[model samples]
Target: MPSRLLPPAGPARALAAAQLVNALGDGAFLVTSALYFSRVVGLPPTRIGLGLTLAWAVGALAGVPLGQLADRRGPRTVAVLLAAATGVSVGSFLFVRGFLPFVLAACCYATAQTGLAAARQALLAALVARRDRTHVLAHLQSTLNAGLAVGAAVGGIALHYGTRAAYLAVFAMDAAAFLLCALVLLRLPEVGPTAAPAAPGRGPRFTVLRDRPYALVTLLNTLLLLRMPLISLAIPLWTVTRTDAPGWLVSALLVLNTGAVMLFQVRTAAGVRDLPSAVRTVARGGALMLASCAVFALSAVDAPVWGAVAALLVAGGLQVAGEMMQSSGAWQIGFDLAPADRQGQYQGFFGMGVPLARMLGPLLLTALVVDWGTPGWLLLGALFLGAGLALGPAVRWAERANSALVSVG
Candidate 1:
């Protein structure tokens, strides 16, 4: 850590640190949110889940518009605004006694989160060179997970000892992080949006949807996202309410998942960094996810607790592997392909698929399960596997298109 040898200690570095801090707070807040809604606010699981869906929908709908705004202004300015807005929104939760006000606060927080996310990703791409982009993105994910580990542990402790005060503390920390992030962003050199790159001939922004290869990548992302509901809402509810498992098992399972991330994500992610093959990377990630789902399906057979635990560990490892591939591929395509001017818009539009899936997937799975029993989970697994298989053609198309483009240039 010699001073002269260190990477530039500017806005980019500062913003990355600030993201870690804010993520820590977010992690703590999420850990307590469900319990707070249930015990403090007296909302049932279904209502809580519905609220999450609404928040996600609001965020997803706002993402593209926020990105467009970031293009007009600067990504830094938009990011700062988003951070401050999120801080205020989270702090407002303290006074919200009823469902309506609470939900409103959640919606506001979600909207700000999406805005900040678009700005953050765009900022990263703008700051880095093409060769280093994948490494930087991987580092960001690892840093976030590290922050989450600390936050989650602290949150659990806070809940066990302090209850509602703990959650409030988490929000307060988030607010502070937002303020710090804004300050750090102000110190960094302003990087203009993609509409105004230094290079000649390339336009300010390339329309991502019009590019079939990128569009297919986005579509694959959406399809992959549909698989997340199993872990996010469906499996937890099924395990806690539908099965004989104890409520504490949910926490245990999460621990297993987090542990796998801690142990495996970085090492696994390095192998897949920003190769020219988006489709192949995505396919690999999808295949791992499919395997994880199959393991999850096996858990439905009334195995012993140890057997279930084993399945959980295996599934969790698969999740980490999938995440590594998906994350690497996503940054490679979204950041590398975009010209300097429109990175914000491209990343923003592409990232919306995540929130869209979050909103839609759970509802569909829940309804199907209610109507079809175990068949719903089976169908979900099938969808994941099919999505993985379908990515082969998409990847081939991307490879050929890229080759043709390179040849023409």
Candidate 2:
């Protein structure tokens, strides 16, 4: 890659490279996992869904403990181990012959993936400056989008060929990606022996569990993360069922989002310096999302194909922009509010929202945004706005409760 294309040659790029690698694997898995199980592994869709749901739930529960391990031992060592474990677990899918085996493998895969996510965040918090973590994460997210797009394309090719060999190849590639991700991670230095556990654990091993304010913040963030499913589920479903726009628009809107993030996420993140700025940015992002919901509602109206396309495009743009803002702000807040030594556990707890969102968002959004139509879209937007606004008070509460840090907001 050109120098301009690379993040400065350091842990940031190393992290980005590792992210891109796993994202490629994840991309392949996301595109083909369902089809592979149904067509080749011989599991029903309902079983597949149930197994994955169970797996991610297990994974979400596993995150904090794993992260605490990272803090106890070392983020780099734990991250590398978890990365390799994820590769092995994903590879386990190739041997799965029944739902029981599949569920077991899926659980292992999800747990390792979830743990790796927390470990990586812990590593980022350890290696990157507090101020720059959000920007680095932005770059990682951009790399993730790029890698997923390419991996999805690879999966698409396998689908086009419609062969068992091609399908297996996608899984194989995905497994390899995580293994390669582990290798990339190995190049980075450990963030040192984990700082001695704060005061040798005065309370619960995972204090983050008892942290009501952080939990509240995570909850609100999880609500905002509904936009995540909105991207993957609601918008595509809405486009297909409710709008007159062409089918290709489904993909185009996704591309618009991916491309926009790649182009703009870093720049968008530059303004968020601390908790207060993060809060304001999130609020503004919420308003943008509110407007986006309204625009999407317009697409359901009786309009020319072009008009609907325009509305969808406008909505998509606003949604992505809002996504960039909230994501950047959330990253900063997740880091800024945590005790410096407890980043691993804090990040682990904070990241629970992701798996939770993945588990819950689809079912919830399908009911609210897709099935309910325009009314649902508006209602969901209101939910987003409300959540974004709630973060301010939640952070205030967190700041007051967390004695290790001063209330910056």
Which portions of model 1 show Cα errors greater than 4 Å? 1-15, 41-47, 161-164, 196-213, 238-249, 273-275, 367-375, 395-409
Per-residue lDDT for 125-163 in model 2, tens only? 888888788878888888899989988998899888878
Structural similarity to truth (TM-score) of each candidate: 0.83, 0.96
Please report the TM-score between candidate 1 and the true structure. Answer: 0.83
Q: Relative to the unseen true structure, what is the Cα RMSD of model 2?
A: 2.2
User: How does residue 384 of candidate 2 score in lDDT?
Assistant: 85
lDDT of 1 by residue, 169-279 (tens): 766876777777677677766866555433676554435556687677667768777756756676677665554546777776666666655555545555544544654
What is the C-alpha local distance difference test score of each model?
A: 0.70, 0.90
User: Candidate 2: minimum summed lDDT over ten consecutive residues — where?
Assistant: 400-409
